[model samples]
Target: MFGVLGPNGAGKSTVLRILMGLWHAQAGSVTFQGARLPPPYDALRAQAGVVFQRATLDDLLTARENLLASGRLYGVRGPRLNERVTELLKVAGLVDRADERVVTWSGGMKRRLELMRALLHRPKLLLMDEPTSGLDEAAFRTFWVQVSRLRMQEGLSVLVSTHRPDEAQKCDRLTVLDEGKQLVTNTTAVLSRYVGGDVVTLEVESPDVTAAVLRASLKVDARVVDNTVRIEHPEGHALIPRVFEALDRGTVKGVTLRPPSLADVFFHLTGRALSSRVSNEPEPMTIRTEGQP
Candidate 1:
């Protein structure tokens, strides 16, 4: 599995749409299996499956009807189509609910139905954009479990786009991006090493001043991101007391020490956190500890 990982508005969806022939790129050529694909990309479309960021099901139709209509669009019909639909419904664990109107189903169930529809034609490549956007932790785990089973069964090559770091970690390889620009591409293990050792994040009233103070006093590179002063050091446990002694009393609001994560890697490369929440929105200046979740 390959992942396109980044924060919001990072062009993940645009890249997927371009590959799916839904949008046209102005300058660059698109290729699949080393062959250049021109407009209307028939070859790529015929061999690829897509699950868009948003839901796109006909609520008025029954789940079975929806799958049947989608199958016919790909020129799949007759007994083969029926057999395929039955197989997919069983795989999705929606066999009992297949005859019900889609509008009555829960969001996760609808997402499962969409996944089955995407695989109706048994395309070789599966492209998913934020497939688990609103799923709870349990539902998210369940969804990916189905994907893994399907991958092994169909020998599929999946390309998924996600802003969530935990979701990206599930990929075999990742391409991290910032504002549509590729920062780096590598395995998760290699990328985590970019910020060696422990990550010390300090929630402070003034991020810029605290960062400058740490750099000037300790001679360590520090970055200010989203009201937090972050430092990468080999000895985080020993650095906390020095940080308090260097800064004025009550200057620091909170302190968190954790091992390196993909979020830390993004911050190391760009001096910015992975979150792209609106600037006007008030976010609590609390970073996740080692095992808060």
Candidate 2:
């Protein structure tokens, strides 16, 4: 699956909406398959399924009923519709709750039902916009497990838009977007490689003193936060002994070394923390209208 990852107001939802023909881009065209997409592109719409951040199922309908309705909307009926509904229930692990009303289901269950409903038509492309929001760790794991299985089994082409780094890393490839502009597209490993090598985190009794001493002694850019000092270096392991020796008389506690992650890649690109930004501002609203797919 491909990913569109960036902070809020980065136009991820706008891009998806434009692709779905729900919103028009003034200066660009959306091409599907091998031809330019037609206005009110019914063919393209029929060949795609989109899942928004919120659940789209009717609360009064049972999970099974919801799937059947979606199938019927896509012109599926009779034995074929029933078989597809049953298969989707099994795939989403919601077979036990198939007859239960959607209002009685948990948040994760609702998300799964929405996914199953999206798959009823068996479209060529699946677009998910922040599909894992508000889910707990366990629920997130289950969702990814199902998504991975679908990709491996059906070879579905998926394009997911998310601001979470962990979620972005799960995709086969990532397309980083910022304020309606494309930044980079690469694998997680390749992006992490840009951050150089291992990161060294030193917990010192006095961060200011340790940072000063390290700067004077070593040729590295050390940033101190509270009681810790973080440094990024090509030879982090080799510098550890020297750091300890420099802080021999000082009150140093411990040291930690870790490989680069998506967080680091983001920081390198944006000069800020993702969690910090997310906490300071409200997430952008993700709206999906009916009659599109």
Using lDDT, give the best candidate's number. Answer: 1
Error (Å) of candidate 2 at residue 81 is: 1.1
- Candidate 1 local distance difference test against the native: 0.88
Candidate 1 RMSD to the real structure: 4.8
**lDDT tens readout by residue for model 1, 1-293:** 99998888888988889888898887688788889989768898888888888778899999999999999999899999999999999999999989999998887898888989999999999999989887766677788999999999999999999888778888999999889898999998898888979999898999999999999999878888766898999989999999999999999988999999887888788778887542223565656889785
Taking the tens digit of each residue's C-alpha lDDT, what string does model 2 give over 1-293? Answer: 88888878888998888777788777777678888876666777788888888888999999999999999998999999999999999999889989988997888888888887888889888899989888877788888898888877766899999888888989878888777888788987788787879888897777887788899888677766434787778888998988888777656667888887676676567655544433323565656789764
TM-scores, all models, native as reference: 0.88, 0.83
Report per-prediction Cα RMSD to one decimal: 4.8, 9.6
